[model samples]
Target: MSPMGIRLSPLGIGVFCLLGLGVLYHVYSGFLTWRFSFLLGSRTGDTVDLRELLAVSVKAAELGGVEVKAVRESNKLNENSKGKTREGADEKLTRGDLLSNKKMANLITSSFPGVQVNTEEHLSEEDKEAVYWNRGIPNEIKEIVKNPKFVSSESITIWIDPLDATHEYTENLVNYVTTMVCVAVNGKPIIGVIHKPFTGYTAWAMVDGGSNAKTRASYNDKTPTIIVSRSHSGAVKDVTRRSFGNQTKILSAGGSGYKVLSLLDVTGNDQETADVYIHDTYIKKWDICAGNAILSALGGHMTNLKGEDIIYTGSDGNEGGLLASIGMDHDALVEKLSSKITSK
Candidate 1:
């Protein structure tokens, strides 16, 4: 009995100490992991900050080499779209024509210096090539684009590379246009941001349990307003007029993010009803994510024409067609429109 006390060999002591150290390390790591998960995990029924959302959109835009100045100009121009025509008088350009138009190409090239143009005749081709050339729009994006489950839920998370044509930035300035990043929850758009680097304009919205999701910055009661895409087809106007009649005033806007933002009343009356609707005849996840987040945060809904909730962050990321509306009547409106639109 060496000292009649608990005696251990050096090896045993070393092993004991090692085990203790390992336990300590694990405990520390577990704590850190939990902290991180808590921060990143989506919380329901919480108000999201709009300023922070805008910051993220701005960062995403900068990554694509879009000039902040151009984004700002685009935002300003969007703001001026009161009582303007949603569709241009000229015949609609085919996918090939829009992608290869010399003027459009020149604008894109001048705005972004290092981008290359790979024209295609079809929308699918343009989308595929964009994903290949722009790493930001990853395979995940393509998967989501093809999948339908993601856009069918009430609460959804959406990710986007607003300007996926960073390389085309040098070749086409307009290619550097801002894109939308959005997250919708409970069939409502809660978080949204628009990053337009070329114009130095970034806008974001977060819904905070309000009956009216429109932002205080751009609300007006004098106008029975509607928002539609400027670059896309005027089919939305046709559908809207058919549903709401000619009494509703429609406004054309560029980019999904801008159109969504316009509904917030950035320069108008807060009490005015700013109903933002989207036909999204050619919708993309990246195009609507940020705007979705903003609207959801404000307690508005963004769904497909079928009245099904849109989801994001799934294996397949497809939303059949987008239909957004502000206030309690969103579901009713969808129901009413679904009966008429074959695309939904």
Candidate 2:
């Protein structure tokens, strides 16, 4: 048959589509930012999912955001909780509370069965002791601990904070609250996810290469915008001024994740604003890990005030302090910060 007379079969069309997969790869993965916003993105999610842990985190964040925001307008953020446990007027605790550790735990466990979860909130002292003693841990969780360091421990924890910046969230500063999850092996972060529910933004990265994404963010700012804790006040301002000097602008913010988000934020009409996040106080590992991954993926850095990377041994008491930044002078910022004395 002549070429014009030959009709293409369905199998031939499939061959053509397969040949053009490079375009499909870009089209499929390029919209990660958009796909994650709606939690409609398809991804693998098993305890062994590794870098795909990013998508599991996005799912958990969606669940947490939905659960938390549902009660915001009706419950008034349970102002009477006094930021305490869910009791009294906070009994239902489903209000505008940003500390939805349990909800996230539930969502994550349900979604990623066999993956160990540790959040900032939890049970009674006796129950805590029981969990610590492994008096009640399920066999599935026990089987996942491949690390020798965790053999004596409860499990290889996916450290999490369902919602950070509870105070700012209660005060209607919703953007500052975020959901975080981190996977650590041998006390080092291998995978991390930082999800900002209010803005529908999520970012994640891993030390290994299962992630199908890379970063293209600009990493240079002469006069950087510095971010500090909005709710907690300390010598952070003075230190920022002293380190970056009068040229840099200071922004009071809440949540370690939120501050890092500001660095990669592109909501500004002009372009993305990249800044440095400084915290002189101790923050939990879950709070910082997800941000660390995103920053690292973008060729940025985060470390203790002593210019050391956190080992993530799972401690809430972080005395090392935090310094995270992206852009041209990242190393210089770290160098200068190393010398700046922190009174905290």
lDDT of each: 0.47, 0.61
Off by over 4 Å in 1: 1-58, 62-158, 164-176, 182-191, 205-214, 217-223, 268-274, 315-319
Query: What does candidate 2 score on TM?
Result: 0.67
lDDT tens string, model 2, 1-344? Answer: 65789887889999989879978888878787555532421223322434234445655666667656665645556554434321112222324433456566655555444556767667333322110111222233234322212121223457787767776666666767777777766666666767666666656655533332233355446677778876553677887778778667888877787777777644632223447788887566877877776676556788887768887665655677888876656567777777775735
lDDT of 2 at 146: 24
Q: Mark the regions of model 2 whose C-alpha exceeds 4 Å error after superposition.
A: 1-47, 80-99, 110-115, 123-155, 210-217, 268-272
Reference-based TM-score of each model:
0.49, 0.67
lDDT, residue 218, candidate 1: 38
Give a tens-digit lDDT track for model 1, residues 72-114.
3344322221132223322222222223222222322232222
